[model samples]
Target: MTRSFSWWAALGRTLLCLVFLQSLLGKMGGFGAVAAQMQQRGLPIPAVVLAVSMALMAVGSVLVISGWRQRLGAALLLVFLVPATLVFHTALEDPQERIQLFKNLAIMGGLLLVIDREAPSDRPVRR
Candidate 1:
Protein backbone atom coordinates (compact mmCIF):
# COMPACT_ATOMS: atom_id res chain seq x y z
CA MET A 1 0.00 0.00 0.00
CA THR A 2 1.11 3.56 -0.58
CA ARG A 3 2.31 5.58 2.37
CA SER A 4 -0.71 7.89 2.32
CA PHE A 5 -3.12 5.00 2.13
CA SER A 6 -1.39 3.31 4.99
CA TRP A 7 -1.59 6.45 7.08
CA TRP A 8 -5.26 6.95 6.41
CA ALA A 9 -6.10 3.35 7.04
CA ALA A 10 -4.19 3.34 10.28
CA LEU A 11 -5.86 6.51 11.45
CA GLY A 12 -9.32 5.25 10.68
CA ARG A 13 -8.65 1.91 12.25
CA THR A 14 -7.24 3.52 15.36
CA LEU A 15 -10.31 5.68 15.78
CA LEU A 16 -12.50 2.64 15.34
CA CYS A 17 -10.42 0.79 17.86
CA LEU A 18 -10.85 3.59 20.35
CA VAL A 19 -14.58 3.52 19.94
CA PHE A 20 -14.56 -0.24 20.38
CA LEU A 21 -12.45 0.00 23.48
CA GLN A 22 -14.63 2.65 25.03
CA SER A 23 -17.76 0.65 24.40
CA LEU A 24 -16.31 -2.59 25.66
CA LEU A 25 -14.83 -1.17 28.80
CA GLY A 26 -17.86 0.93 29.57
CA LYS A 27 -20.32 -1.92 29.25
CA MET A 28 -18.10 -4.26 31.16
CA GLY A 29 -17.72 -1.86 34.02
CA GLY A 30 -21.11 -0.27 33.90
CA PHE A 31 -23.32 -3.31 33.78
CA GLY A 32 -24.58 -2.86 37.30
CA ALA A 33 -25.46 0.79 36.91
CA VAL A 34 -26.98 0.12 33.53
CA ALA A 35 -28.94 -2.79 34.93
CA ALA A 36 -30.30 -0.70 37.74
CA GLN A 37 -31.34 1.89 35.25
CA MET A 38 -32.97 -0.79 33.17
CA GLN A 39 -34.77 -2.10 36.20
CA GLN A 40 -35.99 1.38 36.93
CA ARG A 41 -37.21 1.51 33.36
CA GLY A 42 -39.16 -1.70 33.97
CA LEU A 43 -37.30 -4.32 32.00
CA PRO A 44 -39.20 -7.54 32.43
CA ILE A 45 -36.25 -9.71 33.23
CA PRO A 46 -34.07 -9.34 36.26
CA ALA A 47 -31.03 -7.09 36.34
CA VAL A 48 -28.93 -10.14 35.49
CA VAL A 49 -29.98 -9.64 31.90
CA LEU A 50 -27.81 -6.59 31.77
CA ALA A 51 -24.84 -8.81 32.50
CA VAL A 52 -25.61 -10.78 29.38
CA SER A 53 -25.85 -7.62 27.38
CA MET A 54 -22.52 -6.53 28.75
CA ALA A 55 -20.96 -9.81 27.68
CA LEU A 56 -22.27 -9.45 24.16
CA MET A 57 -21.06 -5.90 23.98
CA ALA A 58 -17.66 -6.91 25.25
CA VAL A 59 -17.26 -9.64 22.66
CA GLY A 60 -18.31 -7.40 19.80
CA SER A 61 -16.13 -4.56 21.01
CA VAL A 62 -13.12 -6.81 21.36
CA LEU A 63 -13.52 -8.26 17.88
CA VAL A 64 -13.93 -4.78 16.47
CA ILE A 65 -10.91 -3.37 18.25
CA SER A 66 -8.78 -6.30 17.19
CA GLY A 67 -10.18 -6.30 13.65
CA TRP A 68 -10.70 -9.97 14.19
CA ARG A 69 -13.88 -11.68 13.09
CA GLN A 70 -15.21 -8.43 11.72
CA ARG A 71 -18.43 -9.75 10.19
CA LEU A 72 -19.45 -11.70 13.23
CA GLY A 73 -18.61 -8.82 15.50
CA ALA A 74 -20.62 -6.38 13.46
CA ALA A 75 -23.52 -8.81 13.29
CA LEU A 76 -23.55 -9.49 17.01
CA LEU A 77 -23.13 -5.84 17.84
CA LEU A 78 -26.01 -4.87 15.63
CA VAL A 79 -28.07 -7.44 17.43
CA PHE A 80 -27.23 -5.86 20.75
CA LEU A 81 -27.59 -2.31 19.57
CA VAL A 82 -30.99 -2.84 17.96
CA PRO A 83 -32.89 -3.59 21.12
CA ALA A 84 -30.85 -1.11 23.08
CA THR A 85 -31.69 1.68 20.71
CA LEU A 86 -35.32 0.69 20.60
CA VAL A 87 -36.15 -0.15 24.18
CA PHE A 88 -34.05 2.34 26.07
CA HIS A 89 -33.68 5.22 23.68
CA THR A 90 -36.69 5.02 21.42
CA ALA A 91 -38.99 4.29 24.31
CA LEU A 92 -37.79 7.50 25.86
CA GLU A 93 -39.44 10.79 25.02
CA ASP A 94 -36.27 12.75 25.82
CA PRO A 95 -34.06 14.18 23.09
CA GLN A 96 -30.60 14.02 24.68
CA GLU A 97 -30.67 10.33 25.53
CA ARG A 98 -32.05 9.67 22.10
CA ILE A 99 -29.15 11.63 20.73
CA GLN A 100 -26.73 9.48 22.69
CA LEU A 101 -28.39 6.43 21.26
CA PHE A 102 -28.02 7.90 17.81
CA LYS A 103 -24.32 8.29 18.49
CA ASN A 104 -24.09 4.56 19.00
CA LEU A 105 -25.80 3.98 15.68
CA ALA A 106 -23.30 6.27 14.06
CA ILE A 107 -20.41 4.29 15.49
CA MET A 108 -22.07 1.12 14.37
CA GLY A 109 -22.33 2.59 10.90
CA GLY A 110 -18.59 3.26 10.82
CA LEU A 111 -17.92 -0.27 12.00
CA LEU A 112 -20.17 -1.71 9.33
CA LEU A 113 -18.48 0.34 6.67
CA VAL A 114 -15.06 -0.85 7.77
CA ILE A 115 -16.14 -4.46 7.93
CA ASP A 116 -17.62 -4.23 4.47
CA ARG A 117 -14.41 -2.81 3.08
CA GLU A 118 -12.37 -5.78 4.28
CA ALA A 119 -12.91 -9.47 3.75
CA PRO A 120 -14.04 -10.79 7.14
CA SER A 121 -11.52 -13.61 7.23
CA ASP A 122 -8.77 -12.21 5.05
CA ARG A 123 -6.40 -11.26 7.84
CA PRO A 124 -6.19 -11.33 11.59
CA VAL A 125 -5.62 -8.15 13.54
CA ARG A 126 -1.93 -7.27 13.41
CA ARG A 127 -1.79 -6.16 17.01
Candidate 2:
Protein backbone atom coordinates (compact mmCIF):
# COMPACT_ATOMS: atom_id res chain seq x y z
CA MET A 1 0.00 0.00 0.00
CA THR A 2 1.10 3.54 -0.59
CA ARG A 3 1.85 5.84 2.33
CA SER A 4 -1.26 7.81 1.49
CA PHE A 5 -3.34 4.64 1.62
CA SER A 6 -1.87 3.70 5.01
CA TRP A 7 -2.73 7.09 6.42
CA TRP A 8 -6.26 6.86 5.09
CA ALA A 9 -6.68 3.36 6.52
CA ALA A 10 -5.67 4.58 9.93
CA LEU A 11 -8.04 7.48 9.65
CA GLY A 12 -10.86 5.14 8.63
CA ARG A 13 -10.23 2.94 11.65
CA THR A 14 -10.32 5.98 13.89
CA LEU A 15 -13.55 7.16 12.32
CA LEU A 16 -15.10 3.74 12.74
CA CYS A 17 -14.34 3.85 16.45
CA LEU A 18 -15.21 7.50 17.05
CA VAL A 19 -18.66 6.66 18.35
CA PHE A 20 -17.30 4.22 20.89
CA LEU A 21 -14.71 6.72 22.03
CA GLN A 22 -17.23 9.49 22.42
CA SER A 23 -19.65 7.16 24.22
CA LEU A 24 -16.99 6.02 26.65
CA LEU A 25 -16.30 9.60 27.61
CA GLY A 26 -19.98 10.38 27.91
CA LYS A 27 -20.66 7.37 30.13
CA MET A 28 -17.72 8.22 32.34
CA GLY A 29 -18.92 11.78 32.66
CA GLY A 30 -22.48 10.80 33.56
CA PHE A 31 -22.06 7.52 35.35
CA GLY A 32 -24.87 7.81 37.83
CA ALA A 33 -27.44 9.05 35.39
CA VAL A 34 -26.47 6.49 32.80
CA ALA A 35 -26.68 3.70 35.31
CA ALA A 36 -30.06 4.92 36.43
CA GLN A 37 -31.22 4.98 32.85
CA MET A 38 -30.07 1.42 32.44
CA GLN A 39 -31.89 0.43 35.60
CA GLN A 40 -35.05 1.98 34.33
CA ARG A 41 -34.64 0.06 31.15
CA GLY A 42 -34.90 -3.21 33.12
CA LEU A 43 -31.29 -4.14 33.04
CA PRO A 44 -30.18 -6.26 35.94
CA ILE A 45 -27.43 -4.82 38.14
CA PRO A 46 -27.28 -1.59 36.18
CA ALA A 47 -24.05 -0.37 37.74
CA VAL A 48 -22.18 -3.55 36.92
CA VAL A 49 -23.56 -3.59 33.41
CA LEU A 50 -22.59 0.02 32.91
CA ALA A 51 -19.07 -0.64 34.15
CA VAL A 52 -18.63 -3.62 31.88
CA SER A 53 -20.04 -1.67 28.96
CA MET A 54 -17.59 1.13 29.62
CA ALA A 55 -14.68 -1.30 29.74
CA LEU A 56 -15.71 -2.89 26.45
CA MET A 57 -16.13 0.50 24.83
CA ALA A 58 -12.74 1.75 26.04
CA VAL A 59 -10.74 -1.39 25.30
CA GLY A 60 -12.54 -2.22 22.07
CA SER A 61 -12.14 1.30 20.74
CA VAL A 62 -8.44 1.29 21.63
CA LEU A 63 -7.87 -2.06 20.02
CA VAL A 64 -9.64 -1.02 16.85
CA ILE A 65 -7.91 2.35 16.71
CA SER A 66 -4.49 0.80 17.18
CA GLY A 67 -5.17 -1.94 14.61
CA TRP A 68 -4.05 -4.58 17.10
CA ARG A 69 -6.29 -7.59 17.38
CA GLN A 70 -8.79 -5.39 15.61
CA ARG A 71 -11.16 -8.26 14.86
CA LEU A 72 -11.36 -9.11 18.52
CA GLY A 73 -12.08 -5.50 19.31
CA ALA A 74 -14.84 -5.37 16.74
CA ALA A 75 -16.27 -8.59 18.13
CA LEU A 76 -16.30 -7.18 21.63
CA LEU A 77 -18.09 -4.10 20.38
CA LEU A 78 -20.59 -6.32 18.56
CA VAL A 79 -21.36 -8.08 21.81
CA PHE A 80 -22.12 -4.73 23.36
CA LEU A 81 -23.90 -3.38 20.34
CA VAL A 82 -26.39 -6.20 19.80
CA PRO A 83 -27.97 -6.11 23.21
CA ALA A 84 -27.84 -2.36 23.56
CA THR A 85 -29.61 -1.91 20.27
CA LEU A 86 -32.26 -4.46 21.10
CA VAL A 87 -32.90 -3.11 24.58
CA PHE A 88 -32.69 0.60 23.99
CA HIS A 89 -33.58 1.16 20.37
CA THR A 90 -36.63 -1.05 20.08
CA ALA A 91 -39.32 1.55 20.17
CA LEU A 92 -40.30 1.46 16.54
CA GLU A 93 -43.14 3.86 17.18
CA ASP A 94 -40.62 6.55 17.96
CA PRO A 95 -38.97 7.92 14.84
CA GLN A 96 -35.84 8.71 16.82
CA GLU A 97 -35.55 5.15 18.04
CA ARG A 98 -36.07 3.93 14.50
CA ILE A 99 -33.25 6.11 13.34
CA GLN A 100 -31.02 4.92 16.14
CA LEU A 101 -31.73 1.29 15.35
CA PHE A 102 -30.74 1.79 11.74
CA LYS A 103 -27.66 3.71 12.78
CA ASN A 104 -26.56 0.91 15.07
CA LEU A 105 -27.20 -1.56 12.28
CA ALA A 106 -25.01 0.50 9.98
CA ILE A 107 -22.26 0.54 12.61
CA MET A 108 -22.61 -3.21 12.93
CA GLY A 109 -22.09 -3.53 9.20
CA GLY A 110 -18.93 -1.43 9.45
CA LEU A 111 -17.61 -3.46 12.33
CA LEU A 112 -18.21 -6.64 10.39
CA LEU A 113 -16.21 -5.16 7.56
CA VAL A 114 -13.44 -4.40 10.01
CA ILE A 115 -13.51 -7.98 11.22
CA ASP A 116 -13.29 -9.31 7.68
CA ARG A 117 -10.61 -6.88 6.55
CA GLU A 118 -7.02 -8.02 6.16
CA ALA A 119 -4.63 -6.23 8.47
CA PRO A 120 -2.36 -3.69 6.80
CA SER A 121 0.76 -5.43 8.05
CA ASP A 122 -0.49 -8.69 6.63
CA ARG A 123 -0.81 -7.28 3.15
CA PRO A 124 2.10 -7.71 0.73
CA VAL A 125 4.02 -4.51 -0.01
CA ARG A 126 3.69 -3.17 -3.50
CA ARG A 127 6.75 -2.16 -5.51
Deviation in angstroms for 39 in model 1?
Answer: 1.7
Q: TM-score of each candidate? A: 0.68, 0.88
lDDT of 1: 0.69
> What is the C-alpha lDDT profile of model 1 across 15-76, one tens digit per residue?
76575467667767776777778888888674667766666767776676555575676677
Model 2: colliding residue pairs: none
Off by over 4 Å in 1: 1-7, 91-93, 118-127
Model 2 regions more than 4 Å off: 1-5, 119-127
In every candidate, how many clashes are there? 0, 0
lDDT of candidates 1 onward, in order: 0.69, 0.90
